[model samples]
Target: MMEFRMKRISRKFSSVLAVISIIIISVMIFSYGCVKKEEKEITIGAVLSLTGKGAKYGEAIRRGIELALEEVNAEPNRIAKIKVVYEDSLSEPQKAVSAFNKLIEIDKVSVVIGPVLSNEVLACAPIANLKKVVILNTSAGTEDLRKAGDYVFRNRESAIPQAIKIAELCRTTIGIEKMSIIYSNSPNGKDYQNAFMKRFEELGGKILQIENYKDGETDFRTQLLKIKESHPQGVYLAGLVTELAYILKQSKELNFKTSFFASAGIEGSKLFEIAGDSAEGVIFGSPAFDPASNEPLIRNFVMKYRQRYNQDPDFFTANAYDALKLIAISIDKAGYSSEGVKNTLYSIKDYPGVGGTTTFDSDGEVIKPIRIKIIKGDQFVSFEKQEK
Candidate 1:
């Protein structure tokens, strides 16, 4: 009887061990399957002017995105690995459309960022909508983009803020009653110039003259001379940075001392580099200011940017970083689905960004502060912050 009892006890212990082993194996297989199933990858497209007049701005934006990606990946709890594929628009509208199609149809990117120039953004915005992909503008600030479609979102403030701020600054600070507007005969230039003209006129300021130039025109002597004869208090330039620099140089040579003001087209350091001392004392309005911003994340970004690129971060780059951050936040908040991302972006309100706090209004316009800066000693110094 004792031997039989011993045999039974041994069998029972062996059976319990076998059951525990089977449970451990099953748990291991289930955990492995879940891990394999949960790996998600996201692809984003960056369509920028990487080879034309806007190349410098595009490169700066790319660098900013690179920096942001580094920081994002370094985090301990990232949801997915993001892959950014770049397409060069060359600052041409048709090329921009082609790139957009490729990104959507071939690369199959879930979302797209940029086409830094307003013309390019306008061209591609429709394609993005037709394809049901989100097109977030990092640098382009054309007012018409707001009405392009529901699929488009601008990270930077629109031309309206710039127009209103410039008008107020000219009226209050400079006491300028008369202004002359010179802009390139392009969609971007005309749009900005019109908005500024409207606001300036609304402030009881007289439009002394309005002149137009082609995009690649090297000689602005005729236009500058015409504006000089008008003798306006200020000459507002709405065009490419290269053209603006040429205008300034030529104006100075002609001994024209009228105060010069520009939209964000003149906010780049390369603009000053190209124009030399001519850029000094020139007032420009931007959707963002680098030094005036007090956010810690922005400060760190500036430091890292300078360290890596040996250049000061401009509004273009800062805006690109903010766009990426907005995408990341949306992904974190709503998961990695296209609809979720779009909904999150549309719902974003008062999100603190490097450029400033961004709140997307009904028209997909980012409501933020616009800042006016004066070029002093080869640097942009803040003159005033315009609250929106």
Candidate 2:
């Protein structure tokens, strides 16, 4: 009876010991897999407006990122080959939220670089903050993006700087004593108009007229005629590339030959295509990389971008390129984790990039100098920089 009892006790003890050993081995294996996963692959995601009103800008951003990733992946000493995944937000806020959720929950990306429009960024940025993912917005310039979250960062300057620069250029460089303004009825358009008017008047320049049209308005003959009646030396037009192009075309049709000063939104080859000869001599503040630049980094980037896309790169391209490079720099400097990248991004300063010397301020807004350009013939030539 005693021997049988001892045998039962020995069997129970052996069974417990076996279970403990299995659990330890399973935990060790799981931890090793996680370490290997972190060391091998880094996933990045994007929520871009590939099929909506913001498609052109989004496509440019996508191309820039692709070019940058190609170079990054080719580096032999790279920590991990970055894998990018994209979801089209269609430039809609609700769609952008869905895309953000998909990237964070399904794709498991540590960082995201898009949602190109300001409205889209506004929708997606808070979710990124909650989910502990880093978001780098390439070109969304609305002041609303500034309030998104600490995880939100922008690569382009907002309308304030561009608007102020335009006002200064009209006053100092062009010597314009009187200006008429026309803007689209969007948030950016309204904000830019107010900024330019405030700064221009403060500089002792007169605003003769202020006109506005809806975003998709086709006929601007009334506004153009009113602006013509003002007889201002300079007409400041703040709008998207398409709207500005249409305005230029219509203004030319109305025989309004007054010199035009536009926002950076008009800085692209598409404007010339739409407005043709009407785009000539149109001065605007541009964030584009100078085509006549001799800098090696600028030259190399331009060559590669042109070769890949078969066209000249614009500010959108340059800013997007810088965005990806900044992300990579942060990842390398502070590891691939979300918190690590977020912390490192704030520490970056004086990053001499092809776009400009990029440095993030306390609000995660990029501070870079913008150049004033004149649409001379078939090209945009650098007229000068805003006087201090």
Per residue, candidate 1 scores C-alpha lDDT tens digits across 1-388 of: 9999999999999999999999999999999976764565678899988998889889988987888877766666576777789999988889989998999899888688898888898888777778788888888767788798888888888776786788778876668999999987877788779988988888889999999998778788899898899999898888878889889988988999989998778777667666789888888788764754567878787888889888778888888888888888888888866677788998988887887888898777888887788788888888653232
**Which tens-of-lDDT digit does each residue in 283-331 have in candidate 2?**
8877746756889999999999888778888878888888888888888
Candidate 2, poorest ten consecutive residues by summed lDDT: 379-388
lDDT of each: 0.83, 0.85
Residue pairs clashing, model 2: none
How many residue pairs clash per model? 0, 0
Q: List the residue pairs that clash in candidate 1.
A: none
TM-score of each: 0.90, 0.86
Off by over 4 Å in 2: 1-39, 385-388
Q: Could you give me the TM-score of model 2 versus the true structure? A: 0.86
Candidate with the greatest lDDT versus the true structure: 2
